[model samples]
Target: MNAPPLELLAARGTDLLVRVAAVACAARELPQLAEELAGLVVRCAEELTFCDVYVLDDDGRVLEASNRPPVPLGDADVGWVAAHGCARPHADGRGVAIPVRCDGATIAVVDVRSAGRCRDEDVALATALAGLFAPVLSSCRRLRAAKEREHAAERFAERAVEVQEAERSRLSREIHDGIAQRLAGLGFHLSAAERALPDDLPETAQQIALARRLCDLAAAETRAAIGGLRPPVLDDLGLSAALATLAREATAARLHVSVTVSGELEDALPDHVQTALYRIAQEAVGNCVRHASATCVDLLLEHDRDRVRLTVADDGVGFSIQDVFAPGRRPDSYGLRGMAERAELLGGRVSVTSRPGVGTTVEAVVPVPASRGRREAGGPG
Candidate 1:
């Protein structure tokens, strides 16, 4: 079959090379542009029976074909093109290998083979297409690198939270076991002294009684501190009881708070998921109390066999979500961003819906299997 004129093919190919660049730029990796690269070469350079795209492996010694299986090309010019950043024509005049360069180094080699003698225009067209792809490949590499770094940062942040929770647990144990126990012992001794003091020494009895009361107060405060560090109820009972306790102890002076936990598999959640849920609820409640001057708040948690959903809704003075989540405009005490980041780290999500004077609802949905799969030791319980 006769092919289009060389001038027309060259003109059309040059125009489509721009399309190639657009495709390659959006592509996150080389393999994504493999088919386009092969088609570009074959359609424009019609003398070629086939086209092959090869990228260097990490070691830079082996070549990897992105479009098809690697075969013995029986021509070593592909390597020469990659190494020298120049096109190498087959000694038999049937093929040409063109280097795809970025920043003075070749990232790929394009090989076009003909059934007969390869046209000079076909070889030049191959070279021009390779040049167009080079910059786009560079951009793709940068994008992939940025994504890898973002993933690394997420891992680091999650690990940091885990370490912080471990420390909190250790401190809680120290306070509960050491200081609280000693205070209790001191209170017992003070009580015994007060009881032994007779009706004759009224002043002395009053002083001992006061000391005992102070000791009891100190012990209560210590226990409260332990609960704050990492609530013991979360470990002793489970997430539902812990959320109920959280609801009771919430410092919403004006809001009437209610916690309703209903689920078939309340005990199925992992430790981290439970902890994250608790924290997200805590943040939402805090937001409601401090920002949303709502009259009432509801903490609802429901779980099925597969996943868990916790919703914190408040009928308060709601604000625009766009304003809250705006870049560089987050309020000083806003925890929505932190909540979202934490949920994402655990393979979950938090959605907040609100408007001016309407209401605000924060809903967190987490897949139990995914969270359980990446479960760590501790979190903000």
Candidate 2:
């Protein structure tokens, strides 16, 4: 056999380098990379006439293929390379099987086929190409793993929110049916007893009056608890009315809070969406009163054609947003996390902006299904 000319070898080497770079750039995903690798092996080696690529997943099953039919998992040569993480010529001396590794673990096996027998140079080139793919594949695998974990976390968060809501509903019913009812009945009995007292029994009448006052206080407290557990306004009047009630309560707490609406919100939102937005607003307002020390707060609800936005802004002394969200910086930032989790479950997002001197604003934007009427003309019920 005659040696190829130096010029021909140099040209092939340059062409191979260019082709490898192209393959690297084009290999974004596992399947695309596998196909490119198989094609590159054949094109890079002058002795190879035809080539086939097979990419095996972690379980030794064929994940992708290029220019060839799927290879059986039980093929001795392919299985051996996958199991032992090595490279070798095919049993019939027509191709090479190379194990693709990442972080010291075999992830895939690349099988390159040729019409004629493969040469030593061909095998070496195929091995080098597979080596180049290892890191890329590793990075891709890690990315995919990270995405899967994120999805799992979101799923877990959603489930937690659902359970929390269920528990709240149950507790609210218990408080309303058991405690609130009993308190109301007690108030009625106290009134009846006071009426039955004689005009001459002044001391007894005074004691009865004090007992009635105490019964009224207890009943009021029970009603407050029931409202806190589950706001009846939310179910009866929808999100806008519920937010108006929140603003009124904030005002009573000495926080100058106002509620504003941009678009008419006549049509009711999905129950879950309305609940999430209301909770977010409620938490934001509470945070302002508790920590912001702001004299005035503004709550805005905007209903657009496709989405609704809620903004809670307070003209108070603001804190560092980063520090609040940083690890171990603020242990009391669970409210913010809860807000974000709730919005995320509805495929929405929450954003908070604040500076040291300027006011802070928390905004939540949630996409509404098109099936829901956007142009409905109604005010907060």
Candidate 3:
């Protein structure tokens, strides 16, 4: 039989590549990508029996084969091609082992081997294939690097939050158990001294009474400071009871507060998630009492199958969220920013809706990690 014309063979090859390009584009994992790449080599370079794709991995800096068993970097001809970025029977595109360099380092290498030697056309095709896939390999590495950085950032944020909570708890304990108690004891002593003092020395009696009043004020302030730190109720009774207590304590001069809890939230979420959601709720409620100038505030906490949602709405004079969180605009309050940061730390998000005359609503939704997913597993069967 006559060999097929070069033009027809090239056309068929081009058509096959076009179809495979779609598959390569859709592939998200390296294994699938390796299969597609292997298909390309098998279809185009039929004379070659071995095709290996080695890609740099995130953990180890060394290049590892993405398809088959590991191919040592110092194997043979492939090693030469990889180290020098040049191929034997040199073509315009270079060699099969020519390293695909990204960021001044070799990120990937494609090795095509035959039993005998690399034909001139075969070497050229292999070079062309590696050159074509170079950008893809580079892009994958970049994307993987970006994801790694993002994950590292998240871990740092989470650890920071945990450390912060521990410090907050320690500080809260000191203020409540130490300073508050001391102030209370001093107030008692002042009261007893006042009773012992003679009425004739009215000026001295007035001084003792005034001292007692100041002691009471200091005790109140100390309690407020303890409340600002991590709430003890979160550890004692969990988030639901804490929010209820928060609502009770949040009632301002004219502000009426209420809390409605839904779903089986007990032991459903990890500690970090619980802490984050509680912080968000605390900020929102504090903002309402301090700044909202509204009368009625509602706090809702819900724990669904795989997530927890919280809503805080108030019938208060609202302000523009854009104006509050805009760049270069540092308002007196960091409450809104704090809420957003807390939610985002746990792979969650917060949304705020407000109109001048209507009201302000803050809603936060947080995902439950799969590892801590006992709610669904132990739910009512």
Candidate 4:
């Protein structure tokens, strides 16, 4: 026959003391916690003269032991405790199984096996032990839950950064290609008309010449502003074409640069991938011209079946990537931070390797989802 439910033991005095002591010890031992939870078992073995006792984790693995052979508790035992999270009593061959409660939930079963049948006093002690175990278990549960919440918060923050970068990219494209191009064209026409004006129309010609010069200056300024927003060729001509255009511009500006594309890029890439590569190259070139006192810069674009990559390297003055992102250290350029954030958002990664004299190379790697098929024709504009 089975033993009684755990409630019967709860009604007695000795059981209550064991239960209270267990909880008190758990609280006191915390943060500096150790194994070996013993209250009822100690009391019963010494004062009450009970048989044997053990403590267990929620998994039912024997955790604490006193005057007992180590219990054989495994996944199945824990499964049983998990399935029935309540206190009860059972009488087997040598002892009785009493439910162990921690934080009001039954996590383990305490088996008190005397040489013979156990007394009512022993059952009471076991019930008291369950009560003590409850609060300690509750504390552990709370700690684990808090850790999970923190991890979730970190992920959310990273996602927010990604969204902001995407918005900037979109805005940059609009300002650079649309409005700036129109302004540049208007300036070009104005200059052309001024040059065609009759020299004999002196006063009229002078006014026209000044107007033309103003237009020319305005056009140059607009183009410069547009370049900061986003490179126009990147949006209109795709990555390869865009890099070539940038190279030409750099050459015109007396900066020596070479661009090379490898791999069979016959597979048209996604627009965002193209944009990221273009921006990275654009930023690298800009940095080379401004910060790196180098004579030459190289831009390379490569695409394979699974991923797309861009590399920009210059033989100029290089700064350490570690120092730039270290705590309390400020970046020499905001563009570097922006570039890193962009790659992370796309489930990709960016690495900048540089030394004092060794030139800087910014590499961006982004994975292309297999579900998205490549365009059979030329790359996106």
| TM-score of model 4 vs. true structure | 0.45
Q: Candidate 3, residues 1-381: lDDT per residue as tens digits?
A: 122333333555677567557755876455456556756775677577667777767653356675366654555555545555555332433334545665565666776666666666665565566666666777776666765575566567668889989899899998888899999999999999998998799999989989999999999889888877977788888888888888778764567888998897445566787788888888887778778888899889888866899999999999876777787685733778778878887778999999887889999998765442432342221
**Best candidate according to TM-score:** 3
> Against the true structure, whose lDDT is highest?
2
User: Model 1, range 1-381, lDDT digits (tens) per residue?
Assistant: 123334433576566656555656555465566556777778766587888888765445665686455433323787777777777888998998878888877777888999999887677777777776677666655654564565465456557667767898999999988999999899889988887888999999888888888999999889878887898888888888988888777743666789987777634676767778887887888788788988889889987766789999999999888887787886733589878877887767999999999999999997664232332321111
lDDT of 3 at 167: 94
Off by over 4 Å in 3: 1-26, 35-51, 57-61, 66-83, 88-106, 112-132, 191-210, 235-241, 251-254, 260-274, 301-310, 319-331, 337-357, 363-381
Candidate 2 residue 221 C-alpha distance from true site, Å? 3.1
Per residue, candidate 2 scores C-alpha lDDT tens digits across 76-191 of: 77767766777868778888778887777677677777777888777767677777677776676565556446546545655766677788889989888898888888888888
Rank by TM-score (best first):
3, 2, 1, 4
Q: At residue 101, what lDDT does model 1 achieve?
A: 82
Question: What shift in Å separates residue 260 of candidate 3 from its native position after superposition?
Answer: 4.6
Between the candidate structures 2 and 3, which one is better when assessed by lDDT? Answer: 2
lDDT of 2: 0.76
Error of 4 at 78 (Å): 30
**lDDT for model 3, on a 0 to 1 scale?**
0.72
Clashing pairs in 1: none
